[model samples]
Target: MSKTRCLLLAVMAYDRYVAICDPLRYSLVMNRGFCVRLVVGSWMAAVPIQVGQTYQVFTLPFCASHHLHHFFCDVPPLLELACADTFWSRVTLHAVILLFAVLPFSMIVISYVRIIRTVLKMHSAPGRHKAFSTCSSHLTVLTLFYGSATAVYFKHCSRDLADTDKYLALSYTVLTPMFNPVIYSMRNREVRIALRKLLWGK
Candidate 1:
């Protein structure tokens, strides 16, 4: 699920890139068939890699306590439970992170860089604002999702910081997703104005 989301987000960034950088070609470039292929391709790419990782983790002889420290069967927590030498497991985890998280994130960054350049070149102030506004929600969601994920996955996990990991995991897995709808919905001008009025009586 996480891997799929990352890839999907990358696809969205590409869609936005095409829309902003080459609006004339947007319809043709992001056609219905092409969109379907992108979605399907993301799933196809993520599933096999995830399955292989799951298989590798479960195959490890967990000689220690069967209880997981974290809320779910995450790779880091599962690795902690394994009594065997987890050199390869750790390697696989890093490999998966590089492929799913880092690579997709890099693609998003590149898309946004070009988007920023294109937006800056716009002569009309409203046009610039509209272009930046179009990306604000996506950028916000990306920051929240990737920030917590990076904090948890990229760090060296230790028993002393297990609680910290749980909180970070909760942010990415629960809180970030929970806020996604609200965040995206606020992209609408009416929604934003209403929200401001409700909060500040403006």
Candidate 2:
């Protein structure tokens, strides 16, 4: 799921970049075959790492007491159970998060910066408004998703994950997905039209 989402987000950032920055070449750049390959590549890249990470955690010997403080069974919470040395595990975890989260996030930021610059240079007010509206929903989703995940996993100490962090995790897992469609509906004319047609046969 994490791998799929990261890949999707990366593709989305590129889609928006092409759409906003090089509208003339958007179709040529983002054709159907290109998109399919991106999806397949994301799965291939993310699966091996996720499998390896899962195996590493489950193989660790836990102490006599078995309890998890967090709401879910992710890497950080599971590591708290390790009876063995955890320095390398923690380092690997951080590196994975940096690769999946920080790197994609940096690409998104760079794309948006170029997008904003391009939008501002547009001569037509309506064109600029349309461009901003198109990117706003994606930007909001990116912020909510990354902001919560970063707060949860990137902490200096995994043992410090409080109940509040659990709520934040909930927001990351639950609220982000829930609000994605809502944000799109509000900001996206095509989505609203499609929803209306589906619901009311309009």
Candidate 3:
């Protein structure tokens, strides 16, 4: 699910890039068929890699206690229980993270770089604001999701760090997702006004 989300977010970034950088061709380029294929491709790409990783992790010999330190059956926690050396398992895990997380993140960054350049070139201040506004929610969600995920996964996993990893996992797995709808819905004017009223009682 996380990998699929990353890929879908990449697709969203591309959609925003075309919408902002080439507004004239946005409709033509992001047609329904293309969008469907992008979604399908994301699922197709994520499933096999995830399945393989799960298989690899479970296939390892388990001599330690079955109890997991983390809340879920994550790679880091599972690796801790493996009786084997786990050197190759850790290496493979990092490689998968690079492919699914880092690569998609790089694509998003590239899209935003070009978007910023295009927005800066616009003559109207309102136009610039609007363009940036369109991306603010996505950027916020991406930061929350990617920042915590990277912290948890890319770190050197160890028994001593298990507690810290669990907290970080909560950020991406629970908190980030919990806030996604609220963050994106803030783009709606009525929602913003209602929020102000609820907060300020005015």
Work out the TM-score per prediction.
Answer: 0.93, 0.88, 0.95
lDDT of 2 by residue, 104-180 (tens): 77887888889999999999999999998888888888888888887877666644557767788888888999998
Output the lDDT of residue 151, model 1: 86
| Model 2 global lDDT (CA atoms, 0 to 1) | 0.83
| Order of quality (lDDT) | 3, 1, 2
Please write out the lDDT profile of model 3 over residues 1-202, one tens digit for every residue: 2899899889999999999999999999999999999999999998889889899987999987998887888887888889999999988888888888889999999999999999999999999999999999999999898888888887765678778889989889899889999999999999999999999999
Report the Cα lDDT for residue 122, model 3.
99
Using TM-score as the measure, which candidate wins? 3
- Candidate 3's C-alpha runs over 4 A off are none
* Candidate 3 lowest-lDDT run of ten: 153-162
Residue-pair clashes per prediction, in order, are 0, 0, 0
lDDT of 2 at 70: 67
Model 2 regions more than 4 Å off:
158-161, 190-202
Span of 10 residues, lowest total lDDT, candidate 1 = 150-159
